[model samples]
Target: MIGRLNHVAIAVPDLDAAIATYRDTLGGEVSAIEPQAEHGVNTVFVTLPNTKIELLGALGENSPIAKFLERNPEGGIHHLCYEVEDILAARDRLLAAGARVLGSGEPRLGAHGKPVLFLHPKDFLGTLVELEQA
Candidate 1:
């Protein structure tokens, strides 16, 4: 049900510093910081050859990323996104297999303006997984 790896999301405490590390130091092409209020994150995508790297910062105190930062302090990989040809179909299959979907079990608009759904971390080897419509 999953396609190519979409992008790896890293939660960072400092968005600007993370962008600079990827852009100036790593010599990666970084996108402008885009605020995703709905997802409670400020995101910057670092373009890579095979896949992209999404740097995420908490949008507000209540943001989930904020809680993640509180746990890690230094920030770390928050999730892994995988592409699906049909997200709803994939969701159904996952549900049938006893996997838990985060949120309302519906796709939300992702940073790329694509439909995306998050799977429960506990269901996937303690790694959060995101499914994006291809």
Candidate 2:
């Protein structure tokens, strides 16, 4: 089952500029500025006490976030991240229920280095689902 909402990912064309604008206009502060090389994204997590907002930008040729932004022009909420208890078990159960996994079977390092896996939105009524370990 899904757990707490980890963060809402938003794809942007530029990370530094977005960070500056957000901080200047909305008084948002960013933390953990990291590059997810495998996922091809440079991101900063804007923390807001109770919740976090992830700003993502393409780092390379085939950045998934960039593609998402290209398709989703509005560039608002990309995916809802829910922390899970067990990623492998979740994947197995989801597969058994006919849900396809977006990445390979192995879980990948996500925000805070937590293991996470994304289920194909095609299986979740068009909402991209993320299963993460607590």
TM-scores, in order shown?
A: 0.94, 0.85
- Model 2 worst lDDT window (10 residues): 71-80
**Candidate 2: residue 30 Cα off by (Å):** 1.9
RMSD of every prediction: 1.1, 2.0
Tens digits of lDDT, candidate 2, 104-128: 7789887568898887877788877
Give per-residue CA lDDT, model 1, range 1-134, as digits (tens).
79999999999999999998999999999999999888789999998989999999999768878878989888899999999999999999999999999999989888789999999999999999999998
lDDT of each: 0.93, 0.80
Model 2 vs. true fold: TM: 0.85
User: What stretches of model 1 exceed 4 Å from their correct place?
Assistant: none
Backbone clash count, each prediction separately: 0, 1
lDDT computed for candidate 1? 0.93
In candidate 2, residue 6 scores what lDDT?
83
